[model samples]
Target chain A: MAANRSIDNFWAVIPAGGAGTRLWPLSRAGAPKFLHDLTGSGMSLLQETWARLAPLAEERFVVVTGRAHRAAVTEQLPSLGPGAVLAEPSPRDSMAAIGLAAALLERDDPDAVMGSFAADHVIADHEAFSESVRVAVDAARADWLVTLGIEPTFPSSAFGYIHLGEDLPGVTGARAVRAFVEKPSTDVAEGYLATGAYRWNAGMFVVRPGVLLDLLARWHPEFAAALRAIAADVSLLEELWPTLPKIALDHAIAEPAAEAGRVAVVPASFAWDDVGDFDSLAGLLDRSGAGTTVLGDSSLVRVFESSGLVVPRSGRVVAVVGLDDVVVVDTPDALLVTTRERAQQVKEIVAGLRDADRHDLT
Target chain B: MAANRSIDNFWAVIPAGGAGTRLWPLSRAGAPKFLHDLTGSGMSLLQETWARLAPLAEERFVVVTGRAHRAAVTEQLPSLGPGAVLAEPSPRDSMAAIGLAAALLERDDPDAVMGSFAADHVIADHEAFSESVRVAVDAARADWLVTLGIEPTFPSSAFGYIHLGEDLPGVTGARAVRAFVEKPSTDVAEGYLATGAYRWNAGMFVVRPGVLLDLLARWHPEFAAALRAIAADVSLLEELWPTLPKIALDHAIAEPAAEAGRVAVVPASFAWDDVGDFDSLAGLLDRSGAGTTVLGDSSLVRVFESSGLVVPRSGRVVAVVGLDDVVVVDTPDALLVTTRERAQQVKEIVAGLRDADRHDLT
Candidate 1:
């Protein structure tokens, strides 16, 4: 495995799922977070991800999204061929979703290495991200599951931590992964930050398609077999997808493989964000001091003596006054108003809406 | 003048102006707050006011609103016959708007006693309001400019105070108004409340049409003469209205009249609110403890761990979470998010929108 080596056999598998329930009204069930131009950028997150990967995975892009978002995914990424966007029949969690892509890549390209990235994430430095992916792809060729470990800037308890072992012998900036820990408490996170040996596990994985499936076969034999069988017979997808176990890829393969001393991590010093909620969205906008950051049309948001993020997607004027860290997401059919601190609680609102049988709103 | 006596020639003068800018996005320039049903009741504030005054000033309603909102006023007050709604050429302030009504009544009925009330105010007890008005009208006939003084519930500096003097010789609940003061400081207001000799001057004025003209003539002879000319020739209103002074009735008449011992106050024990801002609006729609008070369709607003006022007029689902004293006003063309304490600062947002020349939104 060599760093900065271009591998023509590498495919970029973008898992465009997640309704982003916490960012309600802006991110709806029909139109998820991946489809929104959340950072006021001209391109949607999915489009931005495609743009970032196009140079490396040119004509090797495979986007897997829910059945409902098939047309939207294709529309957002017009450069991709019709067959490039794979529509899942049902939500089978990350393991099945990403596993299905691996199974398909395994059959389509015998020597293919794949780098899996979520469609809704925001990466600031494209050159750094691509360089890290190239390094991970080189490591993937050596029959090792590789992940891009982001250098933690702060002791953030919001994400899982990736523990670093000894440096991978012959690979630059690549280290063997000791273990992948779950989201830690603030106290534990601060200690990990102090040691300077742990990185934020952003769920970015690069691996050989065949190797990933084989690793899945060790822990989730039926799940791997179902995904491979479906990849073999595309007609059986609708009948088989729901039968697959609902599990995130981290728990299904990455965590287990790391514990067995078979995984490696590439330390990348680039800004990465999942854009999980309004608070993260506010940080992305970066308007410090007391004034609102309008993600949509600036003309549509009027603020005075206030600071926050206002997403006015409904073509209506949004006025925020005398508030701190407030979030006003005005969509056509629904509205969400909350503070950045209370952003996590928005998930409860979505759950409550679902429980109240307001499926149209949820 | 006898207390509680029903006068045959009494007219209800409703000055239905003011864009209610502080309540912006809900109250607009074309469709002001007077035309909105701020309370959950099934009638607009204007309609509710008309209903409350129907018993005494039967069919004797004169509504003064901006030319832009003339049609909406007539539409809301459908029972009013042709020429009942008086559209102002421009906003000439309270004095000119109400003075026009007085001039019209003076010529139509020499014995008419006009009770001028704003169309946007809310009163909890209709019976108590009517009783106060009857007494005010009684005092009005005795050559006194009568006002309804609401008993202070709190030391709110938002409204002006009417200093009470010795009790009127014959009229019950009626006393001589020592002076009509401007909005006082909270400390001074608290002191006035402690003394129990001050009452909230709700701007509800009652007076004989001719007597009001004579009072105006004493101060601004040219202004009174211009109003009389417009009344004598109804066709001259469009030409003469712009010549009238832009002064509130309180400064032009009430304060001076009170100093001259020609003003009387009927101390009414009833809840009264102008619905000035979202804070006052929330106070009016009081739902103590922790929960949202929906002024529109309750089902449209879904609250979780929120205690505030949510006016969802756009027929969309409004979800407020983890906020205390929050004000969410979601309308079709605009939305306002603020806290009750910072509600007054909403005016700055409105001003900013206006300065930006987004008139359609304002």
Candidate 2:
């Protein structure tokens, strides 16, 4: 692998097929979280993600999404040509999604460095994020599997934690991965934060197509064989994609790579919010006691002035009185009111809507 | 004066013209307070008022409303034809409104006993209300001006107090009005309640056209003269109606009548609610502790289970978490969340809207 090579060899692969139930009512089955303008920003999360990566690797960008959201995915990212929308017949988790992207890139550049990015996360400090990705790509080009580790702001128990190890030999400002811990209890989360060695696993990774394939074959042969079979018929994705086993890249590759001491963590000092639920979004919004984000002609009046989160769309007004640590969202057809800590439980509302057969609202 | 006349002889004249500024956002200028289905019974306040009076009065109903609301008034009261919709050219206070109705009745039947009813009041007991009206009408026929007096349910300072004297002669349940007190201080209200002689002036009255006209001519000569002039030019309502002074019947007639010892009070035991503000409506709503009245597909969830009143419209869900004594009203264009006591101050919201030149909301 060449050192300090041109950025042209780096390709951005955005996996946007996740159903994203956490952001329900706004993000639906037909339109996943990537396409939604949750922050009231003019650009969708996927668009913003593309804008951040486009200047460095414009022509090498590829989006792997469900067949249902192909048109929306393409429409939002016009820089991506007709071939950019890689349609998955069904949602098979991130392993199949990333494998498909890597397999597709192999046809153009077999040794290309691929950066996997989730379509819904928000990175406020784009300069820092770009720098981190650039560092991660440099490590990936050297056959070192790189994962961008977000420096923890709060002891959030919702995300997986990355335990940092000794600094990587050649890669400056990067560390060898000591361990990967699943979501922990609050007490454990606080302990992890106090230790200062753990970073939030932001589910972003950088690796070469051949390196990822070789690692998957060595660790998870079954997934590797499935990916090989799918890659063989990548041109006829509609016919072969549905047969690929659904597994997240985290479980299939990242965990194994970390266990094998091949994974390096590029410490991300940037404000990277996964926007996993309304709570994460609360931190991003410019709010007072209660996290309230009023987008586009929306005003939030917190009567009790207690800590709560409210995100009302444009041309709407949400007045939250005597509420604390709650999330209130006002849409055209439906209004959602949930507690901030229980924002993840909002999926129940969507499930309830589905159970009631209100597909329109769900 | 006939003492045992059929209840049908007492025609109920409901003046639904007042554009009350107290109940704003929901109650607008185009659609006044009378038209709102605040009770979630499908029937509006005006409809409920008419229902309360319909059984007592033999379908001889007359609704005096502004020209702008004639269509809505007529539509709501389908039982009444064009004759029932008394279109006022402009907004004059209750004195001129009562005078005009009396003049119109004088042309039809001088001996007709008329019961003046506010279009937005809620009386729970129909039988007691009807009986009281009968007693008041009989007393009125004998030239004693009768006003229904509601026994105070609480030491409420929002309503004017009517002091009762000895029982009137010839009228079984009616008593002479000793004094008419304006809305009192809290201390005065407590004192009046303790005395057990003060009753809330129900804003209802019964009188014959000839007697009312004579009394008005004798006491408020200038106001009487203006109404007489307007009545003379029946076809020139637009030219004369706007010139009439905006004086309440309480200030112009009842106060003077009490001072002259000519006013009579009917001690009605019916359950009367003015339904004047959101607080009043909150009490009327069927809920225990602090809860809400949701109408038509609205779900009201009180998380902290504190006392609050949420009246979300049909097809909307309002969730009040960790709130107490707050009112949350969600509309398509605007959302109003105020303290339950400050709900009456929603009128200020309308005033602000007017000040901002947002007439569509007002």
- Name the candidate that leads on TM-score: 1
DockQ of each: 0.76, 0.28
Give me the candidate number with maximum lDDT: 1
Give the CAPRI class of candidate 1.
Answer: medium
What fraction of the reference interface contacts is present in each model, in order? 0.87, 0.37
Runs in model 1 with CA error above 4 Å?
A1-5, A78-89, A107-110, A220-244, A287-290, B1-5, B225-241, B287-290
**How would the docking of model 2 be graded?**
acceptable
Candidate 2 collision pairs: A290-A308, B290-B307
* Interface RMSD, model 2, angstroms: 4.7
Instruction: Point out the worst 10-residue segment of candidate 2 chain B by lDDT.
Output: B297-306
lDDT of 1 by residue, A245-333 (tens): 99999999999999998899999988999999999889878836357788888878878778888888889888888888888888888
Model 2's chain A TM-score stands at 0.91
Query: How high is each candidate's TM-score?
Result: 0.92, 0.86
